[model samples]
Each structure stands twice: as C-alpha cells, then as structure tokens.
Target: MDLKPYANYLRAGSAMIAGLAIGLLATVLSLNAGYGFNSLRAGPWTSWPHIGGADIDPYARAVISRSGEAPLGRDQGLAFIARTDSDGAPLDGACDYRIVDPLPAARYWTMTLASPDGRLVANPTERYGYSSVDILRKEGGAFDIDIAREARPGNWLSPGQAQRFVVMLRLYDTPLDIDSTPDPNSFPKIVKLGCA
Candidate 1:
C-alpha cells in the first residue's frame, strides 16, 4: 500500500548506478586515449615531455602506472610516437611507407614499429626496430627506412601480419628545446608509398 517509499529507493539506486557507470567510462577513456597534458606535436610525431618529469600531471602518472611503461627521465631524453603519417593518415600495415629522416640532435636515437598498444610487431626477420648506431645511412648522413610486408632494397622494416601499427622514436641525450616548439622539418616524415 505504501509504494511511494519503494519508488524513492528505486530512483536513488538508479541514479547511483548511472553516476558510477559514467564515471568509470570517463576514466577508462582518458587513460586509453593518451598521456595527459602538454603534448608536443611535430608533424605526425607527438611526445609528452611532462610525463617523464617529476612534475608530471596526475592523469599522466595514472596512465604510466596502468600501462607499466617506464618513461624516460627528463634528463635522459624524450620519446615520441607517430600513429599517423606526415599527411595525417593512420598507419596501416596494408600500406607501404618510407620514413625520411633529418632527425633532431641527439647522442643516440631509435625507431621501432609496434602495435598501437606498444607491443613489438613480429615479423620473419625478427627485427622490431633500428637504432641510430645501426641504421644504414646514405651519403652525407641522410637516411630512409622502408616499411612494408615485402622486402625493400635498403633500410627495410617489415610490418609482418599486423594490420595497424605505430612508430616509436626515442631520442637519448638529445639537445632539443622542450620549452619551445620543435621544428617539424627536423623530424622524420612517414610517407605512405602505396597499399596492397
């Protein structure tokens, strides 16, 4: 006979459930979307300099904790990732690509192919990436790295069977100015050659 009390309880319970659901969704999305705050973008490459520093934002800390990635310290260097080509196209393994270089000043650097989630893409060569010390260079110090399912002539990187991938570039002991905008021209360009 007293249905008003039951209805109020139901309404309160529904509101609490909805609030929880929305809150959880937001957290998940923010964490997965990217490292938070002060992202530096040059061409297709992006890096979160603050994420590697002691003053890192709360959201970035949370992301690093969840991802279990040991970010480079501020004094050590910076890490950048290119999920898209220089023309702003999402990197697809079906398409062949060439990374043309005029890399920023660094004591050392590395370029690697990884799945979007950061795992190395397995291939027949069993090569995940190349370091500055090992990458083949052209005359006068210029270089190009080719990415495809089939082999190319020089500086080849195979994406294997992965349908999608990202390029990770780490500059160790770099002299780059994090306080200012980096030159996009200095960073390498990912050019999509063609698709299968």
Candidate 2:
C-alpha cells in the first residue's frame, strides 16, 4: 500500500553508498600519488623539497605518516629516491646495475638500497648503504656502487632476495637550490648492466 515511498527511500540509500565509496577511493589515490605536488625530478630520481619544511602539505604529511618515514627537516637536508634506471627502466633485483656519481653539492650524502616498502634488503654482507666518507672513490673523487645479487669488487650493494628495490640518496646540509630544477646529469645515474 506504501510501495512508492519505500522505493524512493531505497534509491536514496543506494546513492549515498555509491557516493561514500567514490570519495574514499579518491582520497586513497590522491594520498598515494607520488608524495603530493611540487616534486623536483632529476632523471630517475624524485624529491619533494617541501615535505621536510614547515609548510608541508596535508597530502605529504599523510603519506609520510602512513609510510612511517620521518623526513629530514628543510634546514637539515633533502632526500631523493630513484625507482628506475637512467633509461627509465624499473630497477629489478634480477638485473645488475651501476650507480655512478655526479652527485650534487652537499656537505655529506648517503646511498642506501631498500625494498619498495622502505625496508633494507637482506644481504649476506649485512651492509645496507654507504656514506660519502665511507664509499670507495676513484682517483678523481668519482665513485660507483654496484647493485647485484653476486659479489662485486669495490663498492657493492646487494638487493639480496628482494625482487625489486629503490635507491635512496640523502644529502645532509646540501647547498643545492630547491627553487630551481636541478641538473639531471648532476645526479647519479643508475645504469642497468645485465639481467639474470
């Protein structure tokens, strides 16, 4: 006897559910979409300069918190990550690669290998990274870090059993300009050698 009113209520309920679902999806995607905006990209590397500043955006804050990463303060330094090779290929643990330096001007820097989720790779050497002072360099102050599953001479970093990895480069007390785009050539190049 009151079917018309009941149908109207059902239609409204369905629409409300659809709206909620859409809103939630949008929020998740936005937050996970590359650490907010204003990213400084150099070749395969990307840095969010403002994420460490006082005026950090909500999207950046949410991402950092969700990932459990404590970003360096703006005055302290800047951090960059490379998920791909110089040719724009995703870093694969099955492949051997070389990280060659032309690093930007900084008081100090460190390079580390981590899983995509930010955990250090479990290698037999128990070494996860190298700092500026500790990394092996050539006669001209140039350096290279070899990434491979097998042992390598000089500076080497193994991805261990990880199928994929990311390279994190952190600069401490860097003088590089944040207002302008940095030269991609100045940043280290990840060159893929061969694959297993």
Tell me the spans in candidate 1 whose CA falls farther than 4 Å from its real position: none
lDDT of 2 by residue, 154-180 (tens): 999999988999999999999988899
lDDT tens digits, residue span 1-196, model 1 = 8799899999999999999999999999989989998999999999999898888998899999998999999899999999999999999999999999999999999999999999999999998899999998998989999999998898999999999999999999999988899999999999999998
RMSD of each: 1.0, 1.1
- Cα TM-score per model: 0.96, 0.96
Which residue pairs in model 1 clash with each other?
A: none
Best by lDDT: 1
lDDT agreement with native, every candidate: 0.95, 0.93
Per-candidate total of colliding backbone pairs: 0, 0
